[model samples]
Every structure is written in structure tokens, then in C-alpha cells.
Target: MERIKAIGIDAGSTAIKVVGINEKGNIVFYKVEPTSFQMKPQLEKIIEELPKDVPIGATGYGGDLISNATITASEIRCHSKGAHLFLKGPGTVIDIGGQDSKVIVIDQEGEVIDFTMNDKCAAGTGRFLETTAWRLKTPVEEMARFAEKADREVQVSSVCAVFAESEVISMVAKGEPMEAVIKGLHRALAKRVASLAQSLNIIPPILLSGGVAQNPVIKSMLEEELKEKIIVPPYPQLMGALGAAIISMESKTKVTNR
Candidate 1:
């Protein structure tokens, strides 16, 4: 049983993340699955696999759907707590997920001070990369490699994800190198996210989380665009679920103490 203390679930739009933590707030069990249309049963099945009677903290766009959750938190709160748990201090958090992107400011005590998000469009999200990958007939996993080896970036001028694909097609038609176009896509996405982060009061020790954080080209370009070093956790995509578990543990402990 590993003496599990709490559980966290991030029922994201594109994927679901579940984390089980021991008393020390360290993850002992972790799982992720591509989101299915039948989300409720999927979530319940995962919850059933873990130890019962422990507090469950839920987050993400689908967090509210977890009828069995002990507590549900916002994506902003989950991300802030998750980033603070890893950084162990106040800083800025840039989370780019499949459907949206958010920049949150965390204060010295690991509280959310301010935040901004781009969920109305796909321009600044992981969806943009997915579209680009499909258009180029390149696997999403290989885009970073092409970008890293590129000698130059052929501009992807469209600010909209749909239009950006047209721009990419034009470049490819003109014989632009695949690597150059891929690098350009990364640059465009980084610039878009950087501008979003700069919209708020950015603090130092900036942390990057979410599935997009795994992209090396995106990470490097973000650092260059924002002019700050970016810190990424070992399991960037699992932050939301891990944060939920930690928050639930803390809250339960507080109640027991009182």
C-alpha cells in the first residue's frame, strides 16, 4: 500500500494525470492517460486503483467533474502550489498545456499574486505544435530535434494556429528546409508565450511546467525571449496532479490538528 496519504488528479482536456503521495508529499504512484470522451468512468477507474479513504484533490479544466474528490482547486492554484513545491520559493510559473497557456506569479510564501491565461485561442498552446506536426508529416516528438539542428528559422508569421499552418505550407512550397520551419514554429510559440508572461509582473526563478516544457527548443527559445533562465521539474507534466495531492495532504493535516 506504501502508506499513501493523499491523491491528486488532473483531469486535463487532452490527458488525465493521477498522483499518489506518501506522508512526506513525495509522489509514490503516478499515471497518465490520453483523455477519452467518457471521462467520468475513466477518472473513477483510476481513483479506484489507489488506496481508498484518503483525501483526493482534483484540478484542471475537468476537475469539477470528479464527484468523489475531497477538494477541488483551480488550475491556477494547482499550478502555483505545484511549482512552489518544486522551487520551494516564490517565482513565476509558465504552464503551456494542450488547450491553453497560463502565466502565474507566486509570492514569497508560495501564494498566487497575479496570473494571466490564453485559453480562447490555440496560438500559444501545445495545440499549435500538434497542428504543425500534422501539417509537416513529422511526429510531434521529432519536431524538437529538427528545430535544434536548424541553421536558420523560416518565419511563421501567422499569429493564429490555423493561419500558421497555411504559412508553413507556403514555406514548404517555396522549398524552405523542414528543420528551419520547425525552428521557426518553436520561435513563434516561445515569443507568443513570452509576451503573455510579460503581461504580468514576472518574478525571478521562472519555472516552466506542463507537457510543452519537455520541448528543448521551446525551453531555449523561451529563455532567450524572456531573458531569464527557466527551471523545469523532472516531471513537468505531472505538476498539477502532484500539487493537488500535496494540497489535500496539507489541508487534511490542518483539520486533524484542529
Candidate 2:
């Protein structure tokens, strides 16, 4: 069978991911960039990097803005499709991105059954981690490592992002270690996500997606809260893009057969 090439683009709040897949669904090329402006230039750059013959599909919050793309998909569908490909089970998906978090429930066939999203606030999303990292004088990438070293628990009682910052400051004033504070931040975020998952009656083998899934501490905290193993894809951030690409291939096959 001749391999059909397809491209998938996930234009997110903070970053854009572009992935190319062969007929066998293996990623042939992948790239990521900061979504500095609207996605036009970013899409152009992605198209330039991919093979010209490949068909392209777009998804994510900025998907509709990329008018030249062949097809656009909802971020929820993309994330669920991508996570299901990797996790392979009936479960819930919690995706914490730069500015939002979403909980999606998937059936045994990898279809999205239901979903909830928190796009209105920064409290339960990656923005919380970024804010905490800034205040702790640590890079966001190092947060998980720092959190793992926490020797004692530090409670973050505020649900508001602003109030949580103030609360973290008070904990620091009391000589709380940075590790403990970071751990608390992870736990707090996990608790909110777990609550969302619970609302849908969380099934086993929960899958975590988005950039935050790369953080080991958040994954560990989420697992602890859910009392089940959480699955993280190898390229968690690119799952949406991969899902769009897979969808594009399927669509093209149908058109050709018809």
C-alpha cells in the first residue's frame, strides 16, 4: 500500500504544534512554535516545513482562524482522539494547557462521550504552574523536579489564582521550602482536575494530555488524587495535532473511495 501523507496542526494559546504522518500513522516530522500572533504566519511556517503534497488539517482554539487549512476540528475531539490512540481504554482525559484545562470522557471505542472545560480562569490550568514558577524563581520545567523533593506538605487553600499567589507568599514567609510549595501547587491543580473527572464518574486508566502532562509532579499528583495510574503520551503536547492529522487521512480515504 502506498503511504498517504497527512499533516495536522494544533494552534494553541501558547504554542502551535505541527505534525506529519505517513499512511501507517507514524509521525514523519513534527515541530512546535510559540503562537505569538494569530495562526496565519505560524501555519505558513508549518506548511513550508512539510512536504507539499501532503494534505493538512487543523485543530485547537485557533483552528478556525487558519482558513486555508483543509479541515478544522474541535480541540476536545482532537485531544480525545490523540489521547485515545495512546492510552487505549475507557477513561477520562484531563488536559491542562497554558491557559485552560479540560476533562473529557471517552467510551470503549475511543469516542468522546462528554467533556467539561475551564477556560474562564487560570486557577486549574498551566497558568497556575507558570505563575508559581515565576514567584519561586524557578523555570517551569524544573517544577516537577523541585516538587519531588518536598519533605512536608504545604497547603494552598485559595481557589482564585490571585489569592493563591498571596497564599503562597504567606507560606514562603513562614519559611516553607520551595519544593513543598511546588508540591502543594501541583496537588491543588490536580485536585481541581480530579474533581472535574469525578463529575463524570471517572473510569480507570485516566489519560493526561497537553503541555502540563509533561510535568511528572502533576502526573503523580493526579494519579494520587484519582487513585489510579495516569497515562501520559510520549509527545503529550502534540496529541491534538496528531489527532487532526489522523482525521484528515480518514476523511481523504472516504472521499477517494466515494
Candidate 3:
């Protein structure tokens, strides 16, 4: 069995990400799941699959809920740390999460120097896209590819997710092409997130993380809007968990060296 040195858990608003790493800073095991109302039991089930007795680090909105964690940190700190590990240079980190979207500027050391987030509205989040996809009767997985085939994207006027849904449905009723509508939706989300990063007056390479990074339409639109290259680390969705696990490994090593 591969020896586990530490583990990190990100109990985010919409998903739970768990990552275990060895002493060499390599991921040994990882898992992602929708956030369950019974998070304790769900987490317990995940932990059971991991190697026992490793130090655990936790982050995200529900980090404190992990009673067994040896250390805890905020999502911003952890994500920046994790991105730095991969980026190895100063850059902006734009994470489009399930419930919120954030733009963070990190120095060459990977420390977060400036950051902004929009948690008050679902305007620029995964939920917004999901709701729009449902209205279009399309799977979220296919939205990007479908949008890519459109010759021109229709403009989605509403900024609010609820209003956007209504607008999309109306367009569908009017015989608007689904590809055009989906592309427009992607543009709307990209612009919303772009504003946050632009507020920092920071430049590329923009490192994108979170569940939304998987969407090609959004990623391409964001790059065009920012006029900069975007960097996506491996397992972009697991960045927070990976960061937490890295911290735990460092802490455990410190104790051993002492």
C-alpha cells in the first residue's frame, strides 16, 4: 500500500473534495462529490477509504465541520498556496466555484496580495450555468462544445441567473439556436468573472481553478475578455484540497524534524 503522509479536505458549499498526499508532495488518493446534507457521514465514508493516521488539513466553507482535522486554513490561502506550487510564479488566480466566484492576485511567492469575491449572487457561478443548461434542456457537459459550433452568439441581457433563465426560455420559444444561446450564456458568465479579476489591475497568466474551469466556452471567453493567457493546473477542481494536504505534510515534517 502507498504510504500516506497527510490529507486535505475542502468541504465547499456545493462539493466535498478530499486529497491525500505522500511525503514527496504527490497525490496518492483523491475524490470529489456533491455536498451532502449529512456531510459528517459522507466525510466519514471517504476517510475510511484513505490510509489511516495521517495528519489532516481542512479548508473551504465547511472546514471546521471536520472534527478530526489537525489544522485549518481559509480557502483563499490554500488555493493560492496550491496554485503557487504548480505555477511557481506570481500570477492572478481566478476561481469560479459552485456558489461563488473569486479573483485573487498572488505575488511571486504565491501569497495572496489582493482578492475579490462575489458570494452575494449566483450571477457568475456554476449554479448559474447549471440553471441555464436546464432551461436549454442540455447537459452541462455538452454546453461548451455546443457553444463552440455557433457562428454567432446571441446576447443574454439579464445578469441575474433567474432573469437569465427566463431570457433563455424566451429565446428558445422564439426559435433561437441553442448553440447561440449557450454561447451567450458562457459570455455572460465570463464577463462577470472577468470584472472581478480586472478590478485588481493585474495581468496574466491567469490561473483558473474550481469546478467551472472544466468548461471550454467559459475559459475561452474569459481569455478573450482579459486579453491574456489562462493557466489551469492539473485537477483544477482539487486545488483547495491539494493545498490543504500540502500544508499538512509540511506541518508533519516540521514536527518530525524537531
Candidate 4:
């Protein structure tokens, strides 16, 4: 077994992710759990199970919860690094997290040169779909299915998640097709993130990460809205943690070389 050289934890609003990396910066092991109201105990237990001596890097909204991390980095930096690990060059990274959406522009050297984020509201995030899913009494995953199957979609005019839900209700009341409504909601969310991606002077090789990347509807809609092909890693949700682990390994290697 390759000895784990570093560990990274992403304590996000929707999920907590832990990843261990070998000296070659390969992910050797990983664990993911739905975040609970009390995260400290869950994080502590996960740490207790891993190699205690490995350097730990933490990122995400709840990153500060990990008091003993060797280093803590912003999600923009971590996501950019994680995407770069796969892209290996300049690109734009769009991360539609549970509660926020970030568009990061990475330089040729794989460093973030500019970025934009939509954290002020849920309209531009996975939570937007989640909220609409709840309002429609449909599973979030099933909502994507509904959208994909729709022949055509209605317009979701509101950019506010709450207002969008009300708009959805109004459309449903007006006899709009459920599938059309769902598809419209997804298109609206994708457009919001796409707008963020366009806020910066973006480059090629666009990548999508975070849990939302798994939604086929979102990926397709984003590609349509941005008019660009986007790459989604096999394990999109784990990128933040993987990036942190990569950073840990890189930092450790640098120190040893010095």
C-alpha cells in the first residue's frame, strides 16, 4: 500500500469530504458523509481513523471547524488546484456548490488569476434546484430526469430561489407542464452560473465541479448557456478535498527539498 503523505478535508454545507494522497499526489483513499448540524464530532472521528501524523489541509465553508489543520485554503484556490490536477493547464472552473457558485479562472501556471462567486443568494447554486425540488414534491435527482424528458421548457423568470419557487407554483397553477417547469428551473440555474463564469476574462478547457456537476441536466444546460464544452471529473464532488491533499503533498515535498 502506498503510504499516505497528506490528507485534505472539505467541510462543506452539504457534504464533508476527506481525501488522502500519496507522495505522487494521487488520491489513495477518500471518505464522504452528509454534513450534520454537529460537524466537529464527525470530523474528529474521521481524523482519528486516518494516519494521525500526516499533514492535514482543510477547505470549504466549515473549514474553520478543523482547528488543527496544517493549512487552510479558499475554495477558489482549492477548486482551481483540483481542476488543474486533471486539466494540467489554464482553464475556467465553475463550481456550483450546495450553497454557492464560483467561477475561477486559472492561469497557464495553474494558479488562480481571477474569480467570481455567487454566495449572496441560493438562486445560483444547487440549493436553488433543491428548493424547487422540495416545492414540486420531487426528488432532486428525479427533477433532472423530468427536465431531460421535457419536449420544451417554460421560462423561469425569477433569479431569486424563493421567488422562483413561487413562480413555479404560479406556472403549475396556470396548467404548465410539470416537466417544462422543472426544465425551466434548471435552465434558470444554469444561466445564473453561466453569468458568473462570464464575469471574468475566462479561458478554455472549462471544468465543472461540486455535487451539482453530477446532474446531467445542469451540465448540458450550462454547456448550452456558455456555448462551450465543459469537463466534469469522475469524482467532481471530491475535487476540493483532492486539491487540498495535493497542496499538502506539494508543500511537504517543497519542505523536504529545501
Candidate 5:
């Protein structure tokens, strides 16, 4: 028997993730790259890294722009599908990404009920943290670690990313520790995200998805704000891709069976 392969692509605002799975749903290959506005070139680059015979399924902000995908899916559907695959419960999903953030409510069967998205501003998203990291002379990857070490409270009052950058700079000039500043940043972001979750009457065992879900500091802050346990998948960032792949495989099976 010949092997069957399925590929999933998450073409996000900042990054692109590609994954290949076998008939048994085992990941056989994966690749990630920075996303670019020029979709064709980027798609070509990612496709070059995957198995040639695999059918591609794409989802995310740039999914519609990719011409090579066998199917293009919505980010919301992909994230919800991905979250349900890992969470397997009735609860909410909070996805904080580079340019936007969203809160999705899912039922027991992994279907989305209600959701809210923030794409207008950079205030509570990963871009806010990135700006803070740049101003503090700290790497973005290490910001969460520094926030974890903070013992004192520092407040970032502004919700606007640009104003928050100014606020962080002023705090630094005032001799505030970097950890405290980062902690404050995380707290502000968590507050915004928590507000979104609360809008949907936050339920327990909230699943955190997207790239920012990997930030322990943000997770800790959000947990405190919501007073609930948060679950982070083993590969938080890859959930969307995996979900898309799973959906593609399932649909193919259904078609074949019919």
C-alpha cells in the first residue's frame, strides 16, 4: 500500500508553520518561517521544505492568499478546531498573537459558539511585548522569564502600544527594575485578554493558544486575573496547523468513504 500524507499550513501575520502528517496522524515533517506580504514567494519557500506528494491545507491570515493550498480555512475555525483537539472540553480559548488577539467560546463538541477579536490596535497583543522588549534592551523571548522574576509591582497605565512604550521608557529612567517593568507589561496585556474572556463568562480550564501562549509570564498573569487554570498545549503555536491538518485528513476520509 502506498503511504498517505497530509500537510497543514498556518500562514500567520508574523510566522508560517507547515506540518506533514501520515495516515495515522503522526507528524512526519514540520517547518516554520517568517511570513511575508509576498505570499507566492513565501509559499514557494515553505512548499520546498515539505513532501512533494502531500496535499496541502492552509489556514490563517494569509491562507486565502496562498495559491497552492488544496483548501483555505478561516483562522477562527482552525484555532477552535485546534483547541478542541487538545482541550476536549466546554470552555474558552484565548489566542494572543503578533498583531491581534481573540477569545473563542467552544461547546463540548469543539464547535465555536461566540468569539471576539481585537485587530484594531497593538495594545494587548504580542506587538506590545515586542516594543517593550526593544525599549528595555531585552530580547522578546526573555521578557516572560524576566516577568517571572519580578517581586515588585510596576504599573503600565496606557493600553496603547505606543504610549505604553513611552511609559516603559519613563519607568526605566526612574530606575525601575527590568523585571518589574516586564511584569507590568504582561499584567496589562493579561487584563485586556482576561476582559475578553470574561465577556463570554469565562469557564474553567481555559485553553490558551497562538504563539504568545508560550509566555509563562502572560499565562501566569492571565491565570491570576481569571482565577482559573489555563492549559497550554505541548506545541501551542502549532495547534492551528495541526487542527487544519486533522480537518483535511478527516474530510478526505469522509469523501473516500462516500
Candidate 6:
């Protein structure tokens, strides 16, 4: 058998993100794929592509499905650890994933002291913007570009996924520009996300993570609304997995030292 390094799997609501770390604690490789209800086969397929000899850790909403992992951690803890590992200090963690958005307050030691989550609805998460984008016949990946072209944002009126769709359609009927509508949708979601972040009462440097962090539209809007700078890691979407990997490697050290 070949010797390998630590691995972390984040079975999130919208996607599965995995990261492999070398012995020196640097990320060596990573992968991300959309989640499916038929997750077992999809997970097995991704695992087959990773080194099999390494200790693995798991996190996120679907973490329990990773029954083979050496340990499992909550998405909140994993994201906090991942952000602190890179930031190397105390700060707030704003993770805007697909199904939910959460603000985590972490100490310099990478421990979560307080957190606020918005899982009761999709209005505060990526799913809200995704639904609006689909209604506009715009691809989710292109939303940032579309919003960037607008000179101003129209009032989205409501952030609820269902209501937002109707609002987008009404704007189109009223000859409103697509850019304004898209920007409005982004702002709508940003306002909800900002509320969650404010609830944590934490300050910058705020680290942004999760798949939705890739979108500059929401990021910029959140910055403008909150008047706070947001720091995004290199692999913004893989933070959860990175944290899990860090814990996995540390766990191995504890065992060896013992």
C-alpha cells in the first residue's frame, strides 16, 4: 500500500467539496460537484478518485453519509477552522452556501464562539438567486456579469424565492432592464445575508467561504451594504473540506504522540 496524506469531504446541501492535503499542511488537490439525492453512488465515485490510504474527515449537512471517515465535524466548526487556519486570527466567517447561509464568530484559536444561521428559507441563500436567475433565463454562473453591467439596482421587493421570481417577471413586463433586475436580486439576497452577519455582532476581517462566494455580485453588494471588507480564500468553495482535512491531520498527530 502506498502512503498518503489527509483528506476532507464536505457533503454540502448543493455540492460535495473535497480537498487533499500534503504532509506539510498545504492543500494538494481539490474537487467540487453538485449534490444529488442519489448521493451514495456520486460520493463513492468521487472517493474512488481520491487516495484511499489517507485518513479522512467529513463535514456539512450530509456528513453523516460519509460513514467511512475517521471523524466528522459540523459545517459551522469546519468553516470557522478553515477560515482561521488561513486568516491566522480572530474574525467573522460568512459562509453562503446553496441551501443556507451562516455567520460564525471565531476566536484566534479557530473555535466557534457564536453563530447565526438562516436555514428556515432559501431567501437568504444561493437558492434564492438561482431561482431568480432561472426565471430570467440567465445561467446562474453568468449572474455576476449580468449584474455588473447594470448602472443601478431596482428594488427586488421581496427575497423569497417564489415571490422573487414573480417580481423578476413583473420587472421584465414593465420593460425593466435585465441587468437592473439581476442586480436587484443580488441586493435582495445580500440584505438578508447581511442581517445574519449582523446578528453575530462580529467584525472584520470577515472571511467569505462556500460555493456562493465565487459570485462577486453578492460579495460587492454585501460589502456596500455592510460597509465591511470581505476576505475570500483561494479555494472559497472548499473551506469546509479544508478545515476537515486540518482536523484530520491534527487527529493523526494526536494518535501518534499518544
lDDT of each: 0.89, 0.81, 0.85, 0.88, 0.80, 0.85
Which lDDT value does model 1 have at 176? 97
Tens-digit lDDT track of model 1 for 1-258: 588888899999988999898988888888989899999898878877877778888999789888878888888888888899877888999999999899999997779999999957889999999998999999998999999999999878638998889889899999999899999999889999999999999998999999999998999999999999999998899889988988888775432210
Which 10 consecutive residues of model 5 have the lowest summed lDDT?
Answer: 249-258
Query: Which scores greater on TM-score, model 4 or model 5?
Result: 4
Looking at model 5, residue 32 earns an lDDT score of 74
RMSD of each: 2.6, 3.1, 2.6, 2.8, 3.2, 2.9
* TM-score for each predicted model, relative to the true structure: 0.95, 0.91, 0.94, 0.93, 0.91, 0.94
Ranking by lDDT: 1, 4, 3, 6, 2, 5
Task: Put down candidate 6 lDDT per residue, 1-258, tens digits, no spaces.
Answer: 223488889998899999988877678888888899988888877877877657788998788887678778888888987899777888899999999888999887989889999967889888888888888888999999999999998999654788889978999899999999888888888899998888767867888887789998788888987898988888899999998988887885432210
Flag clash pairs in model 4: none
The whole-model C-alpha lDDT of candidate 2 against the native structure comes to 0.81
Against the true structure, candidate 6 reaches a TM-score of 0.94
Once model 4 is optimally superposed onto the true structure by TM-score, how far is the C-alpha of residue 212 displaced, in angstroms?
0.4
Which residue segments of model 3 deviate by more than 4 Å? 252-258
Provide the clash count, candidate 5.
Answer: 0
Residue 198 in candidate 6, Cα distance off native in Å: 0.7
Better of 4 and 6 by TM-score: 6
Q: Tens digit of lDDT per residue, candidate 5, span 101-203?
A: 8888888887888888885888878888888789888989998888888898698874699889899999999999888988889989999888877877656
User: Native-vs-model 4 lDDT?
Assistant: 0.88
Candidate 3 — number of clashing residue pairs? Answer: 0
Worst 10 residues of 1 by lDDT: 249-258
Best by lDDT: 1
Judged by whole-model lDDT over C-alpha atoms, candidate 6 comes out at 0.85
> Residue 42 of model 5: what lDDT?
79
